[model samples]
Target: MRMKKVSFLLIALVVAAVGFFIGCSPAKEPEKMETVRVAEVTRSIFYAPQYVAIEKGFFEEEGITVDLKTTWGGDKTMTNLLSNSADIALVGSETSIYVEAQGAKDRVINFAQLTQTDGTFLVARKKPEFFAWEQLKGSTFLGQRKGGMPQMAGEFTLKKHGIDPHKDLNLIQNIDFANLPSAFASGSGDYVQLFEPQASLFEKEGMGHIVASFGKESGKLPYTTFMTKESYIKNNNETLERFTKAIYKGQLFVDTHSAEEIAKIIAPYFDDTPEELIATVVDRYKSQNSFATNPLLDKEEWENLQAVMKSAGELPQTVDYSILVNTDLATKAMK
Candidate 1:
């Protein structure tokens, strides 16, 4: 009876010890997720890689939860960034230059470029059997807002083709960016510049015909990029590195995947637009190599962007590429 009692006591003690140890052990904590607020100039198929990153779990994988907002125009997007309403701004590199020219206390920096070429397309009311640059002369041209990247690039291309936008065409610049398509549809101009899938949608609706691409004519530029204030980079270096990594992954996915696959993945973002139309726009951008395959913004592209701005008389003085751009995060991300 004593032996039986002793064995039971031993077993009970062992069980109790085990239970105590199990209960005293520390519990694992959940991973911390950082929220990054992004203000995009506008939402379009032009920013496909960014959409790919968000939809493919790349940003989530890097512990980032994106809070994206469309600010409609560069001015509004920069306003959001400067006011701390957005931590990041996806806009033209020229905005940064303009800010720097104005002597901002905390200068904006272009860390990762998203587009290598312009995104606008020239849509004509009537499809020309043989389209030429000279055809724009004496016609009412509905251009983008003055001093914006699209308008600057359009002017640059027009000069290249020997048709001065101001002298040869009746240029209209007062229309709001969002209303350009509607104005064109309501019989506003002989030609209009637009970003996809609006251009594609217009063609589908028989509202206009795509005659030429500003993206192709303007050559390679650091047209669209992801930028943030310099102070943000200094404070959130690690977060910025992770953000660039996700951007790089997004770029790779777009490069490797077909337009159909990309369109399918990013379809949710454009819920109102048809999948077929998305694919068509994606294919068009892909074919023209509009999307940057990587995040690094090189010096040559920077110089070209400046040239376009200078030609448009929008640039007061050229800002050095090194002062406004930092590729360190992009380099670390790629590795």
Candidate 2:
């Protein structure tokens, strides 16, 4: 009887051990995801892939969550990044150069460039008379007003061609972008400097012709970039790398996807633009096949711009090229 009882106890102990082992054995837990906050200076069809990445969960798939913010222009965008309100700003090289000149090294730095080619154009009246740049010498240019991008861009273009903008051209200021299409349709101003989609609008209105393409003159003006604060890049290096990789992926997507698809992705931001118009613009971009993050700033171009800015009395002193752009993090991400 004693032997039988011992045997029964041993069986029970073995059964308990098996149950404990089965219950406590490690089971795989779901992977923890990382989140990244980001921002953009403006909303345009140009930045469609970023919206697509967020909408399609590409960032999430890469273990990140991106919170994107948009501002009015470069100045406001810089403010957001400096104040820690944003982690990135898609801004012009001109703006980056100005910021770095001020020695805000802790808060400001450029990562990778977004577009190599300048997408700027001067739209003029539709007539044989307005076909050439020389004819545009004395024309009234509808600009963003004094100290605005259009005015400066116009001066750059004019001066590059050895035409005196101040004496030879009339640049009107404070023109609203939303009203530019109708303004041009009414022939309010003889010419206007426009970026994509809006440039397409001028073409569609049958009122304007592109007298000059900025890309034709400037090899690479550094139109837009991925900017970040030094502190963020330092503390969250891994996060930055993942974010940059996601952005490159976004660039690839932008290159492949159709305009209609892009328009659909960015529909939330551009409430006023018709889908048809967006489709037209995207198709145009496809034809151009212009997409890049190459931060190569030509030395001669920089010197030429500096000379122009100096002649226009825009720069107080010569800005160092090295301080103006940041390509390290972006290069790493691409690799």
Candidate 3:
């Protein structure tokens, strides 16, 4: 009887010791996530891939939490990046060239291309039965900011059609970027150049008619891209690679999915805009091949962009494409 009692006591002591050790042991911690602050020039259906990446959890899958903010304009977006308020910037590639021209200490580098073509449409108060470029002559044209990518591409297309933007039309560009749509709705110009959702919404509300796509007319160029400071790339190479992987995944999703499917995924980003309008804008952009299929910024497209800038007399100096662009991360992300 004593032996049985001793054995039971020994067993109970062993069980208690195991339980104490198990209880005292540290618990497994949750995985740490890195947050990347992104400053985008504007929020529109034009940047559908970015939205798709965020909405579909591509960034999260890569252990990244995106903090997206619209800085309203390219200048503002770059300002946020330069001041360290943003880890990455989604703006026109021209902004990086502009910063390089100014000789920034931490030069902005174009890492990934998002939009390969201009994302603007020429909207007129009245739609002609058969629209012609010649009809823009002698009319009041509301262009974008003087040296912006939209205005540069618009002028490039205008010159291609043999219409001198400065001489053939009464051009107005003094309005702020945010006020352009309202200014047009308030009866400001005979015609205006607008981005998506706004362009489609204008048509839906009978405020304006889309006469032509500057994107289709201007040909392919690296219009909008993702950029970051040189130091950021050097210090956070791994993180940037993960970010690029997420971006490439987003680009692939946009490439494979239908406009309606994309619209459904990205609707949360543009909460106010109707899903139908978003889909319409997405279809319009997709039909023109405005959205880039990949994140690689092509050398040919970069040169074409500089050509447009030069045509607009906005090229400070021809900054070497090698100096301003880094495709290493994008290439690695593809694999």
Candidate 4:
């Protein structure tokens, strides 16, 4: 009977050990908290892949619940990021560089580059004399905002052709994108750097002719970036990777998809724009090769963008690009 008791206790101990092992098995990684916040500036057709990622549940598949916020411009989005209101932002390299120089925040790191191709075009009323940059002297140039992409493009284009933006011609700021074509129609702006769809619209309406394309002239400068605060980077590394992975997927989608498919995805944002115009805009992005890259911009390209901004006086001083770029997570995400 004592022998039987010993064997029973040993079996009981073994059962308890097995139970404990089953109970304490690492908790299955806790389902990976599905929540994130991101922001993008402007409502344009080029952002179709981002919309596709969200619409197609790419973020959801990666266990992320995205809260996307849209703002007026990259400057405003930078403000939101510095204030810690948003986690990630789709912004231009020039705008972010200016923000870093201003010392708004210690570390607003830009990881991935988007939009290798600059899609800026100068539109003006068709005249025999207006075909070249030299003829633009003494004309009223309407610009979107001070230090924005349009301004930088205009400055670079003017400087390249030996025309003084400040002396030879007058540049008016605060010209809204929607109103630019109409203003051109009324002869309010002699020449304006308008983006796609708006640029296409002016051409279609016969109000303006494209004087020059800066993308063609400037080679290729890194136009936009996916950025975040330094604090976010340190604490939420996994979230950043997931976001980057989704973005890479979005870029590939943009590369392979049709114009009609792109228009369908971005149609919700541009309600007022006609279907034909939307198609044109999507085709333009495809034809011009304007989308964010996988693992984004490299160090040299980033510096080149800063140089362009510096020449345009967008940045007050030469600031280090390291403070505004973090590619660690993006590199990991690519794999």
> Which is better, 2 or 4, measured by TM-score?
4
Candidate 3 lDDT over 111-179, as tens digits, reads: 998999999999999978989999999999999999999999999999999999899999998998789
Model 1 over residues 183-215: C-alpha lDDT tens digits? Answer: 999999999999999999999999999999999
Q: Quote model 1's TM-score.
A: 0.93
Prediction 3 TM-score vs. true = 0.92
Candidate 3 residue-wise lDDT at 252: 94
Show the lowest summed lDDT stretch of 10 residues, model 3: 195-204
How does residue 236 of candidate 4 score in lDDT? 84
Error of 3 at 234 (Å): 0.6
Query: How many clashes show up in model 4?
Result: 4
Off by over 4 Å in 4: 1-33, 127-130, 174-178
lDDT of 2 by residue, 1-335 (tens): 99999999999999999999989999878678875656676786766656766777778877987777778777888888788787777776566657666766674666665665556677777656536677767788776545433445557777778777777877666676656666767768788877777787767777677767665555444556677777776888777777777777777777777777777776776788888888776666555544563333445645655654565566656876565555566677777
**How far does residue 306 in candidate 4 sit from its true spot (Å)?**
1.5
lDDT of each: 0.96, 0.68, 0.93, 0.76
Off by over 4 Å in 3: 1-27
Sorting all predicted structures by lDDT, with the top scorer first, yields 1, 3, 4, 2
Would you estimate the TM-scores of all the predictions?
0.93, 0.80, 0.92, 0.84
- Over the stretch 145-179, how does candidate 4's per-residue lDDT look in tens digits? 77777677668778989998889988787667667
Off by over 4 Å in 2: 1-29, 105-107, 145-150, 176-182, 257-261, 293-312
Rank order by TM-score, top first? 1, 3, 4, 2
User: Between 3 and 4, whose TM-score is larger?
Assistant: 3
